[model samples]
Target: MVMNKALLAAVALATTMIIMMARPSVQESVYITNHLTKRVLIVHCRSTDTDLGAHAVAVGASFHWNFRENIFGGTFFWCKLAVEDKRIYFLAYDEYVETFGTWFVCDDGVYGTPASRPAFLKAAWTRP
Candidate 1:
């Protein structure tokens, strides 16, 4: 009976581990930084299923949020960015590729950066 109990406990532990591993990340995070010079960068993000709301990031500061993904499929987040009169859009996250972490940013802090980089990041935020 003791041997049987040990065996059952081992099985339960193995099954719990498997379930935990198989499940998608319960909490994932994304970060956005404002590389714009002396400008308050405006960031608004959303998924097909969720609206992450808008944020105003001070220069040299970073904005971030956390959430779970739809592990089944089509898990992605997109963002809208603006500085002064110029505004653009970009992809903040793609679960399939895990394209970036703390993205939509540059240390350069130059205007018209988006024009050169395919708007927002293409493969990044600012999708076509």
Candidate 2:
């Protein structure tokens, strides 16, 4: 009986670990843009050694296309954070990208700024 219990416990533990590892991680960053409202919100996670950053970590994310009577457009997204540490947020319009281009962003704070790549950071928000 003792040996049976031990084996069962081990199996249960292994199953739990496998399930946990199989789950998709949270997004290291997220960006949202309202077509009708023309409002944009970018949330970036920390990539450095510090986790105190107020941004959301982009372990996973999604982007969707929105259409309305007056507005029709699609959002851009990074979805995944390469560094898996630092995240930055920004708010701007589509024209911001045309003006700045890819080299516009200098740091996390500059990521979504007027000079940043606005087209690449648009992401869809998932409802809880």
Candidate 3:
């Protein structure tokens, strides 16, 4: 009886570890292409809590890219999101701030970027 109980406890512990390892991980895929060098760099990020745009703007206020530490300015960028209780939508940036366009996921499974250009630092600050 003692040996049987010990074996059952060991089996349960093994099962739990297996379940944890098999869990899927959520990650962000980032890349940069340099036409001059004809090089493309890629990065994968995993965070339990997803950061939204308003959060990003606040973080951006004190943002500085630490390339020496392998952190990019873009990593500090958080999406300005328009979300409902059940769903979320991504907006794009232009030379100035314009609330137009929608974003979708690409075949690669990462969030798609807006077709418009990057929003200016100046314009983003003034907008409500």
Instruction: Using lDDT, give the best candidate's number.
Output: 1
- TM per candidate comes to 0.63, 0.22, 0.23
Per-residue alpha-carbon lDDT of candidate 1 for residues 31-105, written as tens digits (9 for 90 to 100)? 777766567887899999899788889978888888887755678888888676666766677888735556645
Count: clashes, candidate 3: 2
Model 3: per-residue Cα lDDT over 1-128, one tens digit each: 25698899999989887876665432323321111122121222222233322322121122112111112112222332221221222232221343222223221221433346652222111112
lDDT value, candidate 2, whole model? 0.32
Give residue 42's lDDT in candidate 2 (0 to 100): 37
Displacement of the residue 70 alpha carbon in candidate 3, Å: 26
lDDT of 3: 0.29
| Comparing 1 and 3 on lDDT, the stronger one | 1
Instruction: Pick the TM-score winner.
Output: 1
| Clashes found in each candidate (C-alpha, N, C closer than 3 A) | 6, 20, 2
Which clashing pairs does model 1 show?
Answer: 89-126, 90-125, 90-126, 91-125, 91-126, 121-124
